[model samples]
Target: MPSITLIVNGASKSLEAWDPDMPLLYALRNDLGLHAAKFGCGLAQCGACTVLLDDMPVRSCSIRIADAAGRRVVTAEGLGSPEKPHAVQAAFIAEQAAQCGYCTNGMVMTAVALLRAVPRPSRDEAKQALAGNLCRCGSHERVLRAVQRAADSERA
Candidate 1:
């Protein structure tokens, strides 16, 4: 087994990966107990498994653990705490952006990255940013609103 150390959230963690080819999602979920990134299509088409890899959104399901060695990985749980949620997380709650809540993790992570890059993205830009994330709960409208609200909140 090979040992891989990852900077998860803001802390460093070392784990023995029996197979370095294992997806990073498993290490985050099974080993580190970070469950925000859910298993979706597993092929990386769906953004349910999105996480910030070096401040960019990447599908955790397809990113190999070996490839992510010595990189910054921030899952949705690492975004914020319940008492003080990230702007996007807080906006999601305020706008009721989630029905089943299955896609919220990816949405928040992507939104966070988008905001970091673009700051105040237009409605179309937000939609484009989240186009990959699937939310079958018919929450697209709310999700859009949540992104805008988050931008506004951050501005304030």
Candidate 2:
């Protein structure tokens, strides 16, 4: 157990000596009380625990907390506030993209990261970027639409 400092959601914070092998997902949820990032598969096969590390989506459940030290981590909570929503979050709501809502955060974060990389991703690019994220409720169509909607809204 070694103490490590990490930048999460634009804040510099420190974690006490915890198990180095523990995944970042647990640390964020249990220790940090930031439960927006879900834990779908601890093995990293599922993208349920996606978060942005330097604006790139990464599966939190796969990476150890120690490995995240000194990096900027942005969770869904970091994306937007309740009063002012991020374009992606606003678009998701506008498109009614969520069904059960379990995968929405990760999916939204993935889409946000994708749009950051390519403002106007082609349909295929959108699909490929979101491939790792799974929505068991079959919201892919709406999700894609939401991304496109966000892209449009961002341009406005």
Best by TM-score: 1
lDDT of 2 by residue, 1-156 (tens): 578888999998898845877888888898899988998978777788999988889999998988899999999999898899999999999999999999998899999999999999999999999998988899999999999999998888
| lDDT, candidate 2, at 53 | 88
lDDT of 1 by residue, 1-156 (tens): 799999999999999999999999999999999999999999998899999999999999999999999999999889999999988999999999999988889999999999999998999999999999988999999999999999998899
Model 1 spans with C-alpha error above 4 angstroms: none
Pick the lDDT winner: 1
Model 1 is weakest, by summed lDDT over 10 consecutive residues, at 101-110
Provide TM-scores for the models: 0.99, 0.97
lDDT of the candidates, in the order given:
0.95, 0.91
How far does residue 51 in candidate 2 sit from its true spot (Å)? Answer: 0.2
lDDT comparing candidate 2 with the true structure: 0.91
